[model samples]
Target: KVQESARVSGILHDIGKLVLLEFPDFFKKAKLNKQGRITQDSEYAVLGTSHSEIGGYLLGMWGLPNEIVEAITFHHRPSIQISTKPDLLTVLHTANGLANMCLMEMESDFGTYLDMKYLDAIGVSGYLDEWLSITHQVLDNTDNDQVQT
Candidate 1:
């Protein structure tokens, strides 16, 4: 299923965080001081590299497909990816944004770094309201299921 595939992509998109966690000292030092910019730029400012790049590099080294590596590498900045149509990168980015929105106050910036131009460029901006609605319903269901359990 496309949804299940996208969910897996979403899970792996942030595998960069695991790379960051591998280097606790470096991760501690890398903080995004900038207000409006995305995390990658801030990470570059602090550690001279970004978690996404590191994750991509590691995954590539392990012989993962280039497309998968590319998606993970550009998860935070999917707008920069060079492609004519929407692909896994677009899905991962939108899913990342939707999940963040569902997190509400639990996530910083509340998915603020989401680029409308990117979604517009990818031709998915028109469905954002629908995405949000579906995401919220899914989150609500998850919460209710957890409470019941």
Candidate 2:
């Protein structure tokens, strides 16, 4: 059940970007003025709320599970979560950050980073190295699995 929740949350986490696309002017301003800053901060500055929050709200309105809603809502800043116990939210947050770290360009200023404090609070900080190793291995396998034209 937990894994399913995480999977669903991951799939839906970026749904708000579609909604935000309706306001191209806001995105243009955010990109121009909010370089080198966290994406959620720029989004909030331009749209009055972050995509995570918007996605969460939409999920909630659609009657999705609260776990999925909260996971998507606070994946960018899990330290702000009310519960310190590791759960679906924690998994989603950590996985999202790690994926971003691996896939994003080095020179990009997207500001994707792990919340170590949150992981420490949940007693999961010790697993980061192992998780990163597994991430890299999975990425390697994925690259090898691709069919070249």
Candidate 3:
């Protein structure tokens, strides 16, 4: 059940990226490099709105539950105080971290940087290393499959 909620949270987390459509130059500038690399410098030089915050705003506009909105809003900054402790938010936070790590390894232009306070708030610090390892394994498996195909 929590996983399902988290799935919803993940789906809504990046909804703010849609707002970037308003800034074509910024969007183009933020494109991943040919090698699929993104850096803090590139982001600052490109689109101004980070996807994490945008997603939260989108969720709020859609009238989602406050807990859901908080999850979406604070997934990147989980240290922020929220009215409720939603398990879904924690799940989204962990999943986002894992996904960011995977995307970084894949050389995706999109970068993931979250506050460490989020991990402590979620009570899942020990799982980070494990999740990172699993993310690599998953990437390797996908790469192997692609090579075989």
Candidate 4:
């Protein structure tokens, strides 16, 4: 069940971006920072909200599991969570950080940063190297044609 939750949460974590796309000026108003990075503060400054909140609210309204909603809501800031136990939220957050590192070659301004404190609290901080290696192995196995340039 935890694995399933992680999968679903991962797939829907960015669903709010789809809704944001409806706003014609979203990309324009939500300007990237001087480093060409899109931070949560920048998103809030322009749109008055962040995709995490938007996605979490949507999932909550749909009556999905609270854990899933919480995971999506706090994936970018898992350290704020009160729970010290590692859960789907923790897995999603770690996976996101690893994915960002692996896709560093791509011009994506995802702005995902791993919460080292949270990882340490959850007793997984030491697994980062192993996780990164696995992520690279998976990426290597992916078909080049299916991978976007």
Better of 1 and 2 by TM-score: 2
User: In candidate 2, what are the lDDT values of residues 59-137, reduced to their tens digit?
Assistant: 9999999889999999888888877688998888877776666554332222336887788899987887677667667
Tell me which of candidates 1 and 3 scores higher on lDDT: 1
Across residues 29-63, which tens digit of lDDT does each residue of candidate 1 receive?
65543332236666787678787888888878988
- Give me the candidate number with maximum lDDT: 4
Candidate 2 segments exceeding 4 Å error: 32-38, 105-112, 143-149
lDDT of 3 by residue, 31-61 (tens): 5765464443465566554666677777788
- Residue-by-residue lDDT tens digits, candidate 4, 1-149: 88899889989988777788888787877777554766777778988988888999999999999999999998888888887688889888888777766766422322345888888888988888788889778878986455421
Clashing pairs in 2: none
Tell me the spans in candidate 3 whose CA falls farther than 4 Å from its real position: 28-49, 82-86, 106-112, 137-149
Question: Global lDDT for candidate 4?
Answer: 0.79
Model-by-model lDDT, in order?
Answer: 0.69, 0.76, 0.62, 0.79
Candidate 1 residue pairs in backbone clash? none
lDDT for 88 in candidate 4 is 89
Q: TM-scores, in order shown? A: 0.77, 0.84, 0.65, 0.85
Question: Which residues of candidate 4, in runs, are more than 4 Å off?
Answer: 33-37, 105-112, 144-149
Scored against the true structure, residue 78 in model 2 reaches a CA lDDT of 88
Output the worst ten-in-a-row residue range by lDDT, candidate 2.
103-112
